[model samples]
Target chain A: MSQLNAAARAPLDSRAKMIEFHEVHKYYGDYHALRGISATIREGEFFSLLGPSGCGKTTLLRTIAGFEDISSGAVLIDGKDMSDVAPNKRPTNMVFQSYAIFPHLTVGENVGFGLRRDPRSKAEKAKAVEEALEMVGLKGYGARAAHALSGGQRQRVALARALILKPKVLLLDEPLSALDKKIREQMQVELIKLQREVGITFVLVTHDQEEALVMSDRIAVMFEGEIAQLADPETLYRRPNSRRVADFIGVMNFLPAQILGEAAGHVQLEVGGLGRFEVTEEQASARASGAEPVVGFRPETLTILYEGQQAHDREAPATIDEVVYYGDMTYYDVKLDGVDAPVRISMRNVFGRPVLDVGTRTRVAWSAGALVLFR
Target chain B: MKFSSLKGYAFLYLVFLYAPIVLLPVFAFNSGTIIAFPLKGFTLDWFRDLFANQTLGLALKNSLIIAVSTSILSTTLGVFAARASTRFKFPGKTGVMGLIMLPLVLPEIIIASSLLVVLLAVGMPLSLFTVILGHTLMATPYAIAVLNAAFSSLDRSLEEAAYDLGETKWSTFRLIILPLVTPGIISSALMSFTISLDEFIVAFSLAGKETTLPIYIFSQLRFPKQIPMIMALGTCLVVASIVLLATAEYFRRRGLAKTGAKDTGGFL
Candidate 1:
């Protein structure tokens, strides 16, 4: 996983910008849909706009496809201003959330829809359509009726139809949202592989944070018509800039903290359950959300030490409040001796270790380096 | 042997509706010129006389022209109205659509009289053209009603997909929207044609000398000798209507099959 992250991040500085949004604002009557969205998508990068519903992520994506016009500011595609370009004239294609397969046409006709104006011969276009279908793993399924396919097959056809154009950018609006859990997960991996294979700039809009993290090279987390944070997946997961972003991304346990001192790019903090510790300024977010300062950590970062185990970092004495077990991992909600509320700790279930019961006494091993202080 | 009250009511209602139509064919083929039948022998005389009548032929031609023109004009207007109402939002949209669909409930006599007054005030001479104008005004609301269902059920993204695939707005409508809504268009056109063909108040109020089929039929009702021939004409009209409706239903089912859409109980 770390190797894949390194490879995805290695060529960031040398890539050209494929899409640029410069202070774009969109309004529908009285409601502001996108508030001054400014971002640059690198060439061949798999980017994602992730947010909850009504967060303007889909609206931002439609701007790139020219399906929507901004109320002010500009959008540039491949270094050219796209103010006057129609959707058909723009160098982009979109896979709509509905899949938008033409029910009246066969899969082959739907895949070759964009080639109607191409100067290529009929035979060449047919070959291109077949090749596009094969790329989406629907090689000999061209003659099938579009409306007769299942949900997953329809999505594959939609992907083939959009990719056949070979546009500079491909926009997907919640493409896998309608599939079942198993199919959705399968498509996520397939989409990542397909993006790498095509090497096109893919801008995906999804409400699923896990989907975004798994597929995107970089993600822009949006909330209420504005981007809250934009960074790569690892940075987004490890170092969220705000409490809202942290809460939205994944499970994070918060413990009340007090600031003691700051010097030399390090900050001293007194935490509620884990007692006193210091964190680097990079680990602390300076943005204040008008709440009490809290130090947060992921559930996996806190390990419940078993009998005869040694602690590598600081140790906290706690009592198990609740126990929930999966086949592969066990979660323990433990209350530290000094804290009122229990914080969750996740431990991987090894082959020989037995799962602990509720109300058992335990010691939690944690490190200050894995904690993020949010104010 | 145990019939429900509701079933009996339905059976009686159907008989009440169809018995008059059944009698038209029965009397049309009867040999006697008298309306009352007591085992009258079958004959082709009334049908032969119906074909030889020149005045009836002229009225039929006039009605055909008026109905054809009204159907085309009203359906074209309905397409624009339905598309605009379903796809786009503008100021006072509800009020605009309400006004367009208002004529569906308004009495035809009121529309015919008001249209006659306006056309005469403008010194537009009354003819089959005037009748067609009045019939189109009456039929457009029904056409819009049928077409609104078609346009509203279409996915908006389908048009966007076509546009994104490099087709212009016109081509997208021609290739995608038009073909998809064709069943609705045919339904609307047939409805308009039937309305204009059978309309009496508007044709009587607007047509100065040009007599349509309904006006001629009404005029012939006074002469007792022409009653049998009128029954023959009514029989032919009923047969034509049945054939037209069956053809329309066939096309509608074929369209649904081609697109794999569910059959939601279309017009029979």
Candidate 2:
């Protein structure tokens, strides 16, 4: 939870900036890969470009690594324009999605490859390579053939190889997508600790939203070569500026609502099945494109109040339609007495709490503060 | 084992393929000059005669020069062609590569005659150098085919990774690309060498006054007494070809194993 709080903190403008994209536009023939992107990543921040495939997340990361040339606009690294910099001369390294370990070299040789141009003595360079390997938890693995390592070991080798150079920024392109679920989760925590220890700006490109939420200090959610929403993990999930951003980051239940009236910072809406409620300006976000007005609530925000239990803010009678049992939680789809469709509600399965059966009558408790009006 | 007819057909097919090759060594050691089924007493007289013949010696020298030059020239050109075809997109790519590989399926005599006509029309003298040029044009396709497999299987990210780690484009190629595809280069060179050494139509048509081994062997066929000597030369060629091709195949497999790529059947 503390880690989550750290990830949810915003980077202030007072901090030094590491990378800045000024109206970056990239075109591959007729296809526009990145369209007029302008954003600044602060120094020592764990930033993420989160999106689905073909959303230009990886393409944006490549621009930072100098692997891709922007058709128009400038890319500035530490206040220096990089329009003419070749990838080799740029002060950045990337961990490829495939963990591109050189098959012909030993692990030690691969990690020391970037040191070929370093003016340091051979002994000093070797020591630095060993230190890098030890940092990645692959100590004493230098003599092993690179191709013979397991997939997780190969990923560590890739990390060590890139970090030994101590570049100004480290770019990771889906580095953990190739690992199994358990290892993927473990690596996510390890990567955060490593970033903190190294104090280098990390730019990660990932399609997994939860991974972004768990690791990034600030996340830029992209769609169709445009940033749909850029905010901290908490703000992006709780106060998404558009309906599309809400749907992409997490699950949200939506019901048809009629806009009763609107004021400067308050919106009065009569929501279907759940009755009427007044939402503030911060809660009434605009809908992307022209869609019907609706009020949305997260599954966990609506609780099934047991018999004789008092409502927290508002109460509605409903019958259980379906129940899904997870190990630590239970999800129930309940149809309110006047509602036409069933709405889902998740509850923590505490010890001795009854798991309600289908068709059971129950009272749902909800609050106006949890509602988001998408109009 | 139950399909007796199929088994017999396979046996017949093998004999049809290797029967002529088996006769080369048989006649090479025979002392008889006349072509007959019964073998004469064993003797190395024809082999001795083959060593002493001045014209055969000259033909051997010309063949070596042509084979070495053709292999080097074609493989170098093939490396460039293969790298371009795999790594970049250009207009008319397929058309250009198709034209380069056209000679592989084209009849050898047609290519030889057309090349001779064009060279003479341009007032270029035909010599061992002309033979070398003809052989190189024909052998380039095989070299490209082998090298293309090598380059296409290589991961593009490997080069990018090297560049990201501060190596220049040329050093990236020399350090990573070259070593990864070395086996392929070796295989391509051997293939070009083998093809140019045994080629007959191009050498026969384009060679002027300088006889390659194949041309010399054809001219000797008119004398009945020289048949055994020619058989000795054929036996030697077969052995050399087998050794060369086997080496090429070994290197090809080593390349696949090193890259951890699957073996799609090759020239062997």
Candidate 3:
């Protein structure tokens, strides 16, 4: 971790500093669209810019692709500055959210368009185009006009068009945002495989938390034009450094906690209003220097136990308000005394068992290690 | 839908507008020299006479020269103006665009007469050059209107993707934008030609020594003996105009269809 920390400070020390945005600011006349955005994407990494809408993820992608210019700072490609380079001149291509498939051209022509300028023979271009189509699993779709294809087919064409160029970096602006739920799920799996097959830097911009979590090597959660947190999916979800990052990742329940005592790597916290409790060590060390902080825990960390189980350590006697079956997992909306709202809890479903009905009095227990404290 | 009296009146109005020009060819083919109510047997004599008239022939040449030049020039300027207006923004763009499109609503007589005064003050002679200038100015707005629609309907991302793929702005336009809008350009060229060919008032005001086919035909109307020949000339011109106009309309419709738009809105 210390070596990793030193390496991160020296960006040039890594061979994988594929695209780096430095002090990037963008303005559209009056509106400050992006303010001082800085992030680095490593080579062969499937990185996601995860944020709410209007958080400037798409703008950042566009800027990297050269469709948009940054008002201040530089966008470096592989280490060189790309301040005035146009979109066509960049070593990046984008699979636009709309898929942006040319309606007038056939799928082959659309994919072959970028390769037309290549120093390859006509046969070579044709072979490349064919290979691109095959990669997208749309073999023989070359002759079909873009508009004639289905939504998924269009997406494939879009992917093929961007990927055929063998651009150093491929930007996906919410690529899965347009598809239906089932198709989106399928595409995500296909995208993961495709990313591995290509082994190119893939910078995807999306607002969907689960999409980012499942698909990214690193996820940057943005809020109001700045990165709230940048980490691997697990670390981003479980060890978020800020309250905003915790709230944005998953269904997290936060409660105000006061630190009774503090040390270098430990702190004591009084969390529950009705029943006082103290949590220490790693969780406490994750909080800010002061005592005024918030305690956050994901739903999966909480477990609802039966009434027969005596009130033991790490058990919160919370009554179930509602139960929602999520196929693989069951989500319970629990209302504990002294808590502001119904705290959510998720439990893996066991097959061939009596279900936990709603309005049941049950005690829920979560491992103290799973809880994260934030300022 | 049931037809009504107003529909009957509208149908009559359409016939009234077109009947004389339509009948011109019928009478030109008539064997008799006198154009009267009586039906005469068909002959090709007047058509031959129409081709033989040396002065009329010269006028036809001059009109063709002026119209073709004007069409080419108009379409070129129209392409630039339309592309700029539709695809970009600088400053005072709307005002400049409104000014370019203003001639569509302004009366042609007023425009022609105004050009006469402006050209005379500028020391330009009333000739084919003057006629070409006036026709080009009048026809350009129409060209812009047609091409503007063609350009704006274009998917902007196509060009951006081209740029993203490493093509410069100029190359992107030359390779991508030009191909997409070529149909509109072809239609605009044809439409401008037809309008210039059919134009008379502007030619009359600006073409002093060098009279066009329309002014020549109008001047010949006073001579009683040339009536049959003029009728023949009119018949030929009417036919040619119909063919040109139809060709222009066909290209325009084809252009619109190419861009996936159903409406064939055009200047002519």
Sorted on lDDT, best first, the list reads 1, 2, 3
What local distance difference test score does each model get?
Answer: 0.93, 0.90, 0.82
lDDT of 3 by residue, A18-80 (tens): 999899999989888888988888887788999999998888888899878889989999888
**Which runs of model 3 end up more than 4 angstroms from their true locations?**
A1-15, A84-86, A256-267, A270-274, A280-294, A306-313, A323-331, A347-349, A353-358, B1-38, B222-238, B245-268
Write candidate 1's Cα lDDT for A1-375 as tens digits: 322533654486589999999999999999999999999999988899999999999989999989999999999999999999999999999999999999999999999999999999999999999999999999999899899999999999999999999999999999999999999998988888888889899999999999899888899999999999999998999999998898899888988889999999999999877888899999986454667888889999999998889999899999999999998999899999889889988889999899998899989999999999987
Instruction: For residue B67, give model 1's deviation from the true position in Å.
Output: 1.1
Write model 3 residue lDDT over B122-225, tens digit each, in one string: 88878889899989988899899878877887778778877777778898888778877877887778778878987899899989888788899888889877
Docking verdict class for candidate 2 = medium
Over B1-268, each residue of candidate 1 has an lDDT whose tens digit, in order, gives 8899999999999999999999999999999989895948999999999999999999999999999999999999999999999999999999999998888899988998899899999999999999999999999999999999989889999999999999999999998999889889989999999999999999999999899999999999999999999999999999999999999999998998888887766779
Which of the predicted structures, 1 or 2, would earn the higher lDDT when compared with the native? Answer: 1
Q: What is the lDDT of residue A135 in candidate 1?
A: 97
Candidate 2 C-alpha lDDT tens digits along A168-264: 8999999999999999988898899888888888999999999999999889999999998888888888888788888888788878889889888
* DockQ for the candidates, in order: 0.85, 0.71, 0.42
RMSD of each: 1.6, 2.1, 4.6
Point to the candidate with the largest TM-score. 1
Docking class of 1: high
Better of 1 and 3 by DockQ: 1
